[model samples]
Each structure stands twice: as C-alpha cells, then as structure tokens.
Target chain A: MSEIVLSMKGVEKVFGAFRALGPLDLDLRAGERLGIIGPNGSGKTTLINCITGVYRPDRGSIHFQGRDISHIEAHRRARLGISRSFQIPRPFNGMTVLENLLVPLDYCHIDGSKEERARSVLTSVGLAGRISHPSESLSQLELRKLELARALVGDPKVLIADEAMAGLSEGEIDEVLAILLALNRSGVAVIMIEHIMHAVMRFSERIVCFETGRLIASGTSAEIAENPLVRRVYFGE
Target chain B: MFSIDILLNAIVTGILLGSVYASLALGLAITFGILHIPNIAHPTLVVAGAFFVYTLAQWGLDPIVAAVIGLVPFYVLGLALYLFYSRVFERRGGANVLQSLTLFFGLSLVVEILLVLSFGSELKSVNVSYIGSSLKFGALTVPYRLLIPALLGPVMIAAVWLYLSRTNSGTAIRAVAHEERALSIAGLDPAAVKRHAFGIATATAVVAGAALIMIGPVEPFGGRFQIGRVFAIVVLAGMGSIPGNLVIAIVIGVAEALVASYLNPSWSPGVAFAILLLGLAFRPQGLFGAAR
Candidate 1:
C-alpha cells in the first residue's frame, strides 16, 4: 500500500439529536483518486465538512500525514495543504477572474510573486484569456474552472472537489475530468464528491458509497459497481 | 445665474471640502465598507484622532506631524477594538449588520462622553503657519489650510488603494470581505484578515484627525454632526472601492459647497443624503462597485 496521506478512523458527527455521520473509517493514499457518492442527506457533504474543518467531528480522529489534524481550524488545514471547493461556486463577485485566483495564492504561502503565480494558475486552468472579465460574468463552465483554479493555486496536498462538475454539459464534464486526471498524474491526491455515476466512475480509482450516514460500500470502481448494496442504495435494484 | 467668480470659488472650495470629507470617510470606508462591519463609531474615532492632534498641537507639535505619530497607537487600538467586537459579536454568529451598527453607535457615544469629560465641550483649534494663508490664481482662491490638508486626503486614499490592489495581503483583505470560506480554503486566517483591515481603517483615523484639526476646530461632540455625511460618502462611493471614495467624496463636497454658497448653509447637510439616495436608486452597487 502507498503511504497514507489521510486517515479517518471511526469518525462520527451529530447535530443535536440527529446523527449526521459516524463510525466511518477510511484511508487515502498519496496520489490516489477517491470518489464519494451518496443520495441527498446521506451525509456525504457532512463527511467532507468534517475533514475540511467546517465542522468538528463528535467522535474519532483524522490524521493527515501521520499528524492529528481533526481539531485544527479550516484555514490551518488549508495551509497544511488540504483545500476544498465549495458545492456552490463562491467566487468573489466583485473581483475579476484573475483576482479570484490571486486571493488563494495570497494565502497559500507559495514562494513566488503573486501576479506571476496567479497568471500561471489561471493559464493552467484554461482561464488565461478571460483574466480581465468580472467573476460574475463567467459562464457556468468558466465558474467551475475558476473554482478549480482557486483550489489549485494553493498547491494543495489533498484537493476535495465538492460537486465540481455540477450543472456542466457532457463535453464540459469530460474537460473537467481530464483536468482532474492530469492533476492526479502530477501526484496530488484528490477526493471527488460527485453524484454523476459515469463521471465519478471514470475519474476515481477507488470508490466509496454511503447510505443513511453509514459507509455502505468501498472498493475499486468495478467492485463498487458489482456490489449489491451499492446498486440498491443508488438505483433501487 | 451663476457668475464666473462664484462658480470658480465654489468649484475650488468644493474640491478642498471634498478632500476633507474623504479624510473623514476614509476610516469608515475600510471598517464599514470593506470589512462589512458597519462601524458607526468611525466618526467618533476621527474625533478622537482630532483630539490627539489637538493635544500634540498644544505641546507645540504640528497637527499633521502629530497625527502621523499617533498612527501606530491608533492602529493597535483598532486591533483591540476588532478583537473585542469579534469576540462579542462576530464569534457568536458573525455580527449581523444591524447588531454591529448598534454596538458601534454605543461605542461612539462612549467615546463622545469620554471626550466631553476630558476636554470639556469647547471647540478646539490647532495653530500652524499656513492656517491663514491662501493661493491666488486669477478668479480662483485656494486657502493653504484647505489645500494642504486636502492634499493629504487623496495621498492617503491613493496609498491605501495601491496597498489593496498591488500587495498580496491587500488582496486577501479584499477577498475576506466577500467569501470568508474562500479565504479559509486558501489557507488564510479570515479573522486575522478582518483584524488587519480594521487596523487599516483605524490607522486612517489618525491622518484624518490631523486634517480635521488643520481645517478648523473640533469639539468633543463634533463626530455626531458627521455620522450621516460619512456614511453617505462610503455608500455613494461603493463599499470597499478606495479610489471610488475620492471621486464620490469630491462630488458630494462640491455639491454641498455650491449649495452652501448659493442656496443656504442649512441645505449643505441635506445634499449628502440626497446624493446617497439618488446614487442608491440609480447605482445601488455604487459608481465603481460591481453589482453583487
């Protein structure tokens, strides 16, 4: 097995009397492409939130690079190379596309001039030509690219993409998928939280499925596809 | 009918007055406009700054130089204020706009009361060589008192604008106001950005205080008269647009000066609100702001 980049052991979360997620154990290896899938309210997002420090897990611990990181603040984790994109793209509406990328770079502590890094990041995300346009004026596909660029500027060790391909067309989805594959090829670990079956299966080397806040299946894409529990939870088969 | 002399004087006076207004609104532009903190006490901070200048002037220091010397302590005070405000309100649930406004309002009153107790209600003025001097150019007359302090306003605004646009930490400050989570995910401590922004806002108070003392005199409760006018300028300029504040402040200043000279001094105060209302109706995002 490759070196574990992230480990979540028996993680649990509760909102008042309602249990959002719990007793979940998972591991992500360096440069791995892992996909998380579940129906609405199945605690998929909740799990991501916990790992990203948006919420503190009620039980269990998360270790990143063998260090206890479950309790660190979100920004500190991001500084430690764990970055996430929001489900809804939240670009600074007042800033230009290039400025959006500049913001994350400013915080990432990357060793380079801000303008140089921002321009390079935008170019990498295929946004080189639209640097001057206001962020709000970006098309839906372009917004996704900006969101990805924002996360990418940090040079994150673990990139948690939450619904990155949502509301994009089929062709756009492929473009995003190719980008993710390229990123993974460069050795950055990625956790793709997606609802689209084909896209998730195509991008992930490993897959995990959740049902009612519990991990129902975890295996390779082919294995997950063949699992009866996953089929029932996903398609009511 | 507007005569050439009247028009020239009004325009010159308006420009000078606008610079003063810019100084007055600069701190609020950062605290309320950029940081989204609705610091109603901003004018009071300016008043406090003016008093500092006055105290230094009494000790034979130039008002402008005194304000400069006071910047460090005021910046530190701003940090403390932000920490307190954040702990009491923002940390609880992120301060709602109305709640913040109320807190700042109370703070303003506390500052005003403290000033009254310390310096009494008498109006205080600072003396310098140029306070009574003026420049003559044909039909236009520009008072040195107005022109010198006025220059400080734009200088401060330009410096801040450059800082916000050209520097890395400045970009983070601008972004923190918009998408706080985005800042967090970018590896920045959002609260720290806000605190820095608040410090920047407070730092402006020192420069503006010097300008206030230089322009004329300031009383313990002088900040009360400026509350509506400064808010009007920040809103009219578009929040967080530092350069935009200069243009908006000048426009309002000219309008107020023209009204005071030609119409009535009483009408000068109303012009700011009128401009604010009109600006909001026409361009709610402000003249230079992106429509959110």
Candidate 2:
C-alpha cells in the first residue's frame, strides 16, 4: 500500500558452483519494518549483501527509491542512504566511539558540524557518556550500540541490521530492539535479519522466511507462525 | 675508553641520521602501516625521486625546491600504482601476502633497472651551496646537509600527524586499514581512500629523496641497502603511528651510531634488524601501538 523504497526483481547470487541466494524477487516499502529469518547459511546474509551492494547479484536488478542501483558501488549505495550493521560488530578498533560515528558522517557529507552530529547520535544511542572511549574498550552492549550509532549516523533511508542482537542477553536484546523500533518510527525503512525469534516477531510489521536462498513464506507475524512451510524449514519439523 | 666529547658527538650525529631515516620511512608508514599494502618497492621509488631531483638540480633548482615541485607528479604516479595494484590484486578478493610481496619485489627490480638504464650505474650527488658547509658548536659539528634534511623529517611528520588526527579524510584513511567495509557503509569509497593514501605515500618519497641525496651520493641501486632498515623502522614504530616513526628511527640511528663508535662500524648495519627482532619478540604491537 505504501511507496516501494527498494525493490529486487529475479535476483540471483551464485558462488562458483553453489547458488548462494536468489532467482527470486523481494520489495521493501518506505517506512516499513520487515523481518527476515533463516537458519545458518540460508542466504540471509547473501540477500543483505546484494541490497547493500556488497555483492553484485549474478542476475536481475535492484531499484532503490525508483532508481536502478544493482551495478552501483557499495559506498555510493550508502551515500544514497543504504546502510547496514554487520552481524558481528566491526567498529574501527583504533578510533574512539565519537570517531567511529564521525567516519560515516564525514563520508556522507551530512550538513552541520560533525562533532555535534556525532555527539547527538551517541546521545540517541545512550552512549553519550563514553564519547571519547576507544572502541576496543567497549563492552558487548556498548559495542552493539556503537555499531547501531555508526549505521544511524549516515541518516540512511534503509537500515539493514544483520543479526545485530546476536549473542546479547535478553535485556540487551530488548535494548537494541527498542533502538531499531525507535529508528523505524522516525520514517526509516528497516530490514531486521535476526535469530532472536521473540525480538523479530515483536519488531516486524511483516515477516519473510528464507530457506536455501528462496523466500518460503511472507505474512503477518501470526500468519507466519502458523505457516507450515516456515515451521518445516525454520524449526526443521 | 670512549671520551665524553666523542660520545656526545656520536649521539648528536645519530639523532641527525635518524631524522633523515624518518623521512625515508614516512611513505612506508602510510602504504604498509595504514593501507596494509606491502609495498617493498617504496625505497626504490625514493631512489627514483632522488634521480628526479638530481636531473632537476642540473637546471639550477634547489633540491628541496625541486622536491616540492615534484610532489604532484609523484602523487599521480602513486594513484596510478594503487589502481594497478587494486585491479590486479585487491579487486579480486584481495591478494595474499606472498603474491603482493612478489609483485612489489618485481616492481622494485623494474624501477632499479629503469634507473640504471637512464642514469647509468655511476653515483650521482646533488650540488647545493650548503653541501660543503657545517655549523660548529664547540666539540660538536652538524653538517649543513645533515641538519637540513634532518629538520625536514619532523616538519613533515607534524604536518602529516595533524592531517591524520584533525581531518576527516585522514580519519577515513586510518579507518580504512581497520575495517574498509565500515568506511564504505559510511558512504565513503574504500578504494578511493586507499588510492589517495597511496598517492600521499608516494608524494612523501620526493621529499625523502631530496633528503637522501643531500646526505650523500646515490647510485641506481642505493635503495637496496635501505630496504631492511626502513621496514624495521616502520614495524618498530607501531605500524601506522606517524609520531612513533620519528622516535623509533632516531632510536635506531643512535644505536647504529653507538655501534659504529664504541663497537664495530661493520656491525652498524645490523642495529635495525637487531632492534626489530627484539621489538617483534617482546612488543609486537610496537612501542606506541596498542595490542591488536
């Protein structure tokens, strides 16, 4: 019902002899919360990589904000407002928390002072107190927060968070979920690829399940929970 | 027994020598330390820069003035080299260590051969008014050549350090080595950052070349002898630590001077490696670098 911010048509990604993902189609609407789930190596990462321009899909095309971006470079895609957080936090270890945010802000050429913007992002992520702390010194929770802050600093239109809550405690999971939810509420379309079932279910407005590079089911959370194909592939019934 | 005056003079000379060493190693600090490019051909490039300066000196230009003028073309050459390297190696999932080493080694040989063919195998030196002068301070004598080149190192280092610490492009360069994807996802092209960095690295070679020829005559293959010492300086300085490069270079220079004066002059060449081996064994993160 909403405007399509990102659309993928017949996308396929092959790794030598293996088909890593696609020969399928997907779309993300503007200001929508879409959740994707699959078991280990189920092409979830491949899909995200395709959309973020990390991997050039072997076939088909991707359109973002009505412009074809399948052949665009990853950084240019980011400048066009496509940003993501890695499954494992990959903060620039040599930099401070403030410096980490500054990289994206500076690269994106965002308006206003970089320090003020970095400080504001840090503050939003509840990391205002540790602005000058080196990224290597952060705890697990803070590292996760810093990763999110780095992604958010770009002012991305579409934020693909890949397993961002992995390895966190229930409380930490809740915290990150809240951040993503707040970000979505601010009109940014979010694609959450998470293994935390309860968190994804609670955050997603709609859910899509992937199995071996194909979308097996797409529906509301309740319909997906009741879908037999999703149960079989996700729960291995 | 070593006289107090002799010891003082050796230390002072060592410091001066170390400063020049820092200039030579600055490019490596960027290419190897920051960009993680194992450009073993860096010293060869410095020799090329020296030769370029030498040719220009014939036209009545000061070596330093020629070096400053030469930064532009050398930077463009660096960009082209990085592009060539990335296209051949980095673009296809990155080159392994041995492959990159081999490529750079071959490139160095090519550069040396070119230098030989063009300039002949004979030694070349830059003739400047200050070349034959020295500033005497009591028992200590600082040659104008050594003092001039030595001063260039700290000035360059300070300027580069400020650029790295206080600028956005500089921060992106530092971050590129750590997580290139982080840079990309932040809307900056990682390859472009590396290309720029490589250009900066190569540009430093011009000034360093000027400094080298100021110290003494340079032959086509003069860079070969410096390979080990320069690498030792970069690694011992904690990879990308710009300030650390100067300090470690000075330390190695002083140690080498001490060996030449109190120990054996023949043993002076081994000082860098000895310190490098010790640093790797004891503090692999380097003197100023944090644990990886």
Q: Candidate 2: TM-score?
A: 0.98
TM-score of chain B of each: 0.98, 0.99
Give the per-residue lDDT digits (tens) of candidate 1, residues B172-266.
88888889987887888999999988998998998998898888889978888898999999988888788888999999999998998889988
lDDT of each: 0.89, 0.92
Clashes per model (N, Cα, C within 3 A): 0, 1
Q: Give iRMSD, candidate 1.
A: 1.1
A234 Cα displacement, candidate 1 (Å): 1.7
Query: How far in Å is the alpha carbon of B235 misplaced in model 1?
Result: 1.1
Q: What fraction of the reference interface contacts is present in each model, in order? A: 0.91, 0.87
Give candidate 2 regions above 4 Å deviation: none
How high is each candidate's TM-score?
A: 0.97, 0.98
